[model samples]
Target chain A: MLFSIHADGPVPIYEQIVAQVIYGVAAGAVKVGSFIPSVRELAEQLLVHPNTVARAYQDLERLGVVTPRRGRGMEVTSQAPTACRSKRRDLVRRRIRDALREAAASALTPDEIRNLVDEELTAVNGKRR
Target chain B: MDPIIETHDLCKRFGGKRAVDGMSLAVPKGAIFALLGDNGAGKTTTIRMLTGQLPADRGSAKILGQDCWAAAEKLRLKVGYVPERPRYYDWMTIAEIGWFAAGFHAAEFYTRYQQWLDKFKLDANARLDAISKGEYAKVGLALALAIDPEVLILDEPTSGLDLLVRQEFLGSMVGMAAEGRTILISSHQIGEVERVASHVAFIASGKLLLTATMDELRQRIIRLKLRYEAEPPDAAVFGSVLQTNGSGKHWQAVLQDPRLEALETLKRTDGIHDMEVSTLHLEEIYCALLARKV
Candidate 1:
């Protein structure tokens, strides 16, 4: 599975994993019943702790995005796409709320904040494309 | 809820020198807290005090709500300590050592011993005297985990391991933390600590300089590299700039800003060609923080 993380972001590494997996499911990169790498493998790939990856997997499982199968590793669930998308939207909303708070604190105009968000969105989409 | 580990004005002295001076910290429960410092910076002394192996010259420490020194016997049973250089009986095999260490716990050792032996990939038949240093460290870690303690205190657990083994060891520690075990690890390996620790306390010259979450500390330190069109920028606003070199036209220095308010100070300066605001790794920040004290 393709996994990408933003090292410079404010989010913790585990949360980043959670967000990315949610994004992956929503984008169909990880389909229903698709097997994800073991915690050790993912942590090695990300140069993080296996426990960090495990935390993400556990969180995903709690949200019904993935199911843990003993020694078989984690697998995406049939309800993953919708649940993941919902979770992603909630996360994005929280981020926006935080951004808005920062903008207000800095006394930035709505246009300036909107333009900043637009610029970030454009950059993200441009990279994806 | 009370902190799982706490010290109030804790001090440790050796002869005339004080290793830890007036140190105080409270680590939240179920968090991976790290102590970052240079050698002789009191990291080891702090760990010893927390584990109740050494008495504090002043103040006190509490581990799991029990006095670290006064109630050491009961407290020690609940705590698992992996010293920097863990020693084992050379005459014993890995299995024998496991069995010996397991004697302290009230539970059956076979299941947990087998689990840890598999987790650490240690051969039960291998003798402690014959294993490599890294292997020995793994055995020590396995012994620590097999006891099923409430708190883990590790002092440079992966100090001498190769990169691969170090990664594996850290992976195992992280797994332990996932099970809601509180861990306090002291190590000079900032990158590895950054991977697993939720909080960090940096010490220097026997003093606790800063204690904050990993995310909070990252946001506090900013690395700025500037190329000016003229002479070097004035140093008054940036607190103290260290290592200002590159002749008169260009200069670079690591600056300290506890609140990261220096960016505004930089924006006010003129004759600047280019500047980049970047984050400093934990190692760089540790070095800078200690260097400033000197």
Candidate 2:
């Protein structure tokens, strides 16, 4: 769905697909049993190798978050929400680690960094309303 | 799964100059392998050897289990080669050439050959000289597929093509790979290759830098920018240091692999204050990698 990828960035294209799909499921943007884009479809859309998309789909299937049908293509499994919730934590942790690293690099004290995080959280929550 | 195409210490020379020197690579079956190198990097030389056009001075090459040089005539029917700049027969119409090549293939393959013509939307009656470069590429592709080749070698198929033509060409390549045909494409277009290639090999100065799945290369290469309170001493904790720039407190180095422990050690070292890590694109990594040889 509404996914953006940086081709020049360090993250591999297939891994990007894996991360975005998990986020899509966790955020309820992708419904259970809904059909995801096939390997050819996504490859044409993303201008990536079809095998890359195939690898991403295979990873999702292996993790029990997606399933393959004989003729209907791949679909988000009913377990997607539950599986994605746990996967989302690790993804979030990696982001936070990078953000914290950046903050420390900026010479900001830990208390000030914590205050900045709180302020950002308040701003995000205010927009959620 | 054995490699459908492979070369062992392949060597070639033109006069006193070495064109391809001790070059070796393997293309596993069903892979879309991108062979990338700068101009004069001997990519064409390597491809010529694999396609049985040029014999190696010292080494050997094989295609689909047959020795390329020893069985050149037999292998030509099996390995389809599309040159970067094809010299077409100006007198023949696109359909005429297709029919000419069709004689070599089975009757059933002609059906698929016709299908490919429709897929490319090529006017069969159009004379070869009247078509655009893109259309000429389609004609070449049509002829290649008409032969029912098991492996396709395309040299710079998308070079100088417009966006739409490149899209169509790439689309056809993906479709071909899906059908289990091994593809070895040589091109300077890193972005396009990154999009459609399952595996990639880098060659420079007739020497191969590396060959790996696209994901593996991305995972191993990285860049680190450091801002220390004082000048930091150089260290080689990772594999190879491709580049190091900046001076005094602000220094940036591109390392092959910046693992956690190596980074932590950099942080733990004296005078280190702040650091940032970034991943490199394939193009940028190749420049850095090739620069070492010069």
Candidate 3:
């Protein structure tokens, strides 16, 4: 239920919401059938436009990570965690591929690319620890 | 409750000059409403009347559905205010001042006090007089939030803060709004208000100019840049020309309309090579409204 959006970031707010919700589900922070705050409530909480939250919710519902009930608010689905985990893996692979392509274009050696990846991994692991 | 705050033809007169004249507004439960105006546009006078700090010369105001002046003591506990220039006992530390204010409400001072202090990044031991203006503003905000009143009235909460501090204050206010607390903030920081406010009430020359949702306000006013071959297009065809700049080859004007008819009219004019239509920012709308009043 806690999240922050960066206005100056390259990722749009809707995408950020989607990413956070996915992360929350994958991390088991949001359990199945847990009632997420309403779109209006989350929009007010994040200080963003309601439509932006609505767009994120719509995307989440379409992807089967969350389901909206009549008169009730959105709830995480049972399949949400696995779905989010798979999505996260795909996203990370896509980003790594893109970075590798750039490195190749710049004539960076494989060892140099691997060293850069290792440094990033170490930083991520440090944060997690 | 009826409304957290309500006014009926409230007027404040200083000698022959009217600071606030026949101003009326309603703040609904748990909504972040902004009272917007220039420095001398009666915003302060209206807040003073609503908070019962100053009596109105004519008309009436109610806070928490009680008469603001007659029942000032009863309503004081229900409302928490951070004035434009917060004056505290200069000798007190941040913690002492917070606990002193919280004592009035019989609240558990340290729990809410520490939470607010940490959120605002204020040192618990800092003296009120020793901190910078921005840090003092943080302490003022922390004090107000610690009270946990149903209605919060802030007058230019981040008037003197740098960009980062301003963002932090706005973020805190936005978080409070999410908890269903009513807030009425008066500020010249149009962009921040536009981000957090659900409704905006604009005042000019001691009169209410417009009150609308952010979406409605954005839809009402528009910026138009017109490029013509040799002569500038006639502005009369537009609904109301808010501003006009540039000369022969090109010109720009802000137009207000319920629809795009004025834009279409300009597009149909002769020698009009290009015309760009876009939304107006809150500052632009405010400037246009004040100019119209003048």
Candidate 4:
């Protein structure tokens, strides 16, 4: 899986690694049975502590996103794509919910919030086209 | 598991000044522990004591459960040290120094030293004085790693190196820790430390201010920017406020491990109209922590 990490970001490094792996699987950028970077490899590449990478890998294992295989560091599980799709949706929904909460807190009317969301959605889709 | 390196109330005095006073730390195996502080904050003093180069006047320092002061010679083989200014004989070439250091280690030392030199791309015959500062730093690290020590203690090893060299140095540390080596590095470079260190200890004025895992620090230290209708709530209302800034209805407060109750109370308050809470990077957190003490 290929992803960039922001060392100075608010999100912890390990969480970033876990999220990126899930995102990759969800997007089909990483296929099932393919192995992700080993802890040592990722740590060296990112210049982060290996234990941080290990923690991320462990969390991935617990989430059923990846499994350890003989000689293979961490192979993506068969269920990883489906599992990650739901996880990705939940992650995006949570972010949208937070944005909606902020808009409501700022005293924007429900209709105004709807209009703003629609506007942004159109802008994003238009850019994609 | 027992800590690979530890200090208990370790105190060192120099001419009546307590350089490292009642200091204690526990560094587990495979940890990248960063010791951070301002200049003259006794970081170097503490590192020296841990390496057994300087004796503690009170309490004790231990590495691998052996007394640092008493077992200095025995522990020497198990611990590698790279000082801030690693000075070798000016006329000695890189290869010559490697040969010189090999005398104290097993026969494998020379071979490993050569491998590291090759990896670092240092010319073996380059004299100590002829190499660039970055190359000189790499030489120090290469020599230290040649011993294949279980623990490495570095004092500002990358202080003056360029960005690329510094990144390379930290990358090597990541690989070493993966192999279960404990590393204790004292540095003022908070950004670099944040990237690589699993645990961090902050000291100031000869005393330890805070010690925590990076994850804990990330979870706890928070900066909240609040705008009020009239006047802001007393900064103290936010429990564990480290520092507060801004004036009038606009205010920013950095809180340390704030309680949930305090946040709820702020949300229910009448005057507070808006609040934005964000996590802090290690550099920002360090500044807020030190500024709070001031």
Candidate 5:
């Protein structure tokens, strides 16, 4: 999987890996039954500690996103798509809520906030086109 | 599991100055523990004690449950050491140096040393004196790992290395730790070590300031910026602040509040009109914690 890790970002590196895996599965970029990189492989590739990657893999396993495949590496689970899509929605919703909170804290009126959100949606849609 | 390396009140004095003072640390097995500090902050002194190069003035240090000073010779066989500037006989070739080291280690050393030479891409026939500093360091690392020691002690091993060599060194360290080997490295290179270190112990002025797992540090400490409509309260209002900056209406603080109770309280405080709370990267966290000492 393609992972763009921001080592210096506020998010912990392992958490970033976990989120990216979910995002990938949700977007259909990572197919079910495909194996992700092994802990050692990902650690060397990302130049991070193997333990960090292991922790991410362990969390993914617990969340039912991936499963150990005997001698092979971790395979994406069949149920991952449904679980990850809902998780992705929840993640985006939380972010939007935080943004709305910030807007409200700025003393913007509700109408002003609504218009700002509309403008942001239009800009994002334009970029998509 | 017991810590692979542990020290309690480990103190060392160089004449009147305390080079290491009352340092207590635990390096868990299989951990990439970074002894982080600025130059002259007693990192080398602590490593010296741990490697049994210098006996501590007071207290004790143990590696693999053996006293560092008492069983120095026995511990040497089980521990691999790479110093900041590794030195070898100038006339000896790289191959000769490895052969010389293999004599003191297990029989497997010969094959492992050769494998490492190939992996590091060092020419076996290159004279130690003729090789670049980076190559010299690589030779030292190769010899150290060839022993297959349970623990590796590195004192600023990457100081003279180039960017790619440093990355290679760190990648090798990750690979080693994955095999259940413990590594203790002393370095002031916070950004480079941040990715590989599982736990970090911050030392300053010969004293240990903090020791924590990287994940714990990430989850606990919080950086907060607050803007008050009126004058800001005393910095002490947030209880024990690690570091604070700015003044009057605007203020910033790094607090070690696991539950973020302080941040929640400040958000509801009467005069505070705006606030921003976020976790920091390791480098930023290190500086914020050390700012008070400076």
Candidate 6:
């Protein structure tokens, strides 16, 4: 239910919502068959237009990540986590691609970029430990 | 999609000053559209014309396919208008005023409106003259919803409201919009409107400067800062540059719809040292847009 966004990002807000929800499912943050807040509820919480949230919900439904329950409102589909794995991987690839692009722009060689990535991964792991 | 409200070249003058001049706008159905402008920028006049409260001097406005001026009685049934600082019979209590206002609708509507009144927590017995500005606003909202109106025209609905009341008012609007009611709200509260409004129309000195979806506005109006080796003379490379000014090496430029090519051009340029792109907030963008009377 919590997501961060760059308002100026090339990706629109509705897409961000779809990607964030999918990421949540694939990453174990959102369990399968759990209830996601209704569009109005999410819009108020995020302070966005309800239509925006509704569009995201519709996209998620189209992607089979969420399903409409007759009485209980929207719930994540049972197969959503598996369905979202590829999208989650795509998100990871985008971040890695961005980092590599930046490193290339900074004139780093492949070996130097690998070392930088290794150092960053170690730091992240250390924090986790 | 058919617009719930449409106006064409709507003109209005007050004491030789053109309050609304050649204003044309379309509010899409089910959209929570915000008409934003500074005071005396004809927001009130436009709202008046749209709601059929005041006739336009020239041109026309339509709400729900009925001419706003000629067919006001018919259109009033579908549209609920709440003007700024709504006047009420001071002698009447909230309950009395509500009952009086409900006379415009059927008894069933009045029955359904009781829930809304409860939601707003209005003391029906309290005199209108004795209530706070926020309480009076709640009364106004209660009556407006009493008819289950298809369109709600709110002119500065949250102007004098306190923090909690304003929050509640905004919450009610969200609920109403979810029910598929078209809302045209005019307010100076850019931050609040930015959160809820699907579309925005910026008016300055009786003329519209921009009308766009909130997302489009955020993406299109951008501010960029660049540091160059010397006085940068190539701001035109950025598409639709609005204004640019800075001394020798550092220059800041505001642009509309700045493209990636421009950024790439700046990046590859020899003299440019740094470039920063930023999205302006609605308030800042409004000021920048209206600064030159455009």
- Cα deviation at B165, candidate 3, in Å, is 2.1
Better of 1 and 2 by DockQ: 2
Model 1 lDDT vs. the true structure? 0.80
Candidate 6 lDDT by residue in tens digits, B1-294: 888899999999999999999998999887899999989999999998887789999988998878999998888878888889889998999888877877878787667667777888887789989999999988887888888899999999999899888877887788778888999999988877877889999998898888888878877888888888855846667867777889868889888778878688778888887788887878877887877454
Residues B1-294, model 1: lDDT tens digits? 889999999998999998999999998877789998878989999988898889899988999888898998897777888999988899999999888877777676556877988977889999989998889998887777777878999998889899889877877777666667888999877777887777899998689988987667765665666788867766546655533446656666666553246656675678776766666777877877777677
Model 2, A4-70: lDDT tens digits are: 7667766777889999999999999999989998787777677677788888899999999889989
Give the least accurate 10-residue stretch of model 2 chain A, judged by summed lDDT.
Answer: A2-11
Which regions of candidate 5 deviate over 4 angstroms? A94-129, B257-259
Candidate 6 displacement at residue A106 in angstroms: 9.6
Per-model TM-score versus the true fold: 0.75, 0.88, 0.71, 0.92, 0.91, 0.87
Error of 6 at B269 (Å): 3.7
The CA lDDT of each predicted structure is: 0.80, 0.85, 0.81, 0.91, 0.89, 0.85
Write model 5 residue lDDT over A19-111, tens digit each, in one string: 999999999999999999999889888878788999999999999999999999899999999999999999899999999999989999999
Misplaced by over 4 Å in model 3 are A1-129, B1-3, B107-110, B228-237, B259-273
Provide interface RMSD per model, one decimal.
Answer: 4.0, 1.8, 5.3, 0.8, 1.1, 3.0
- Looking at model 5, give its docking quality level: medium
Best model number under TM-score: 4
Clashing pairs in 4: none
The model with the greatest lDDT is 4
List model 3 lDDT by residue over A1-129, tens digit each.
Answer: 679877434355678999999989987888999988897678756776565577789999999999988889998998999999999899889998999999999999999999999999999999999
Tell me how far the alpha carbon of residue A83 in candidate 5 is from the true structure, in angstroms, after superposition.
1.5
Candidate 2 whole-model C-alpha lDDT, 0 to 1: 0.85
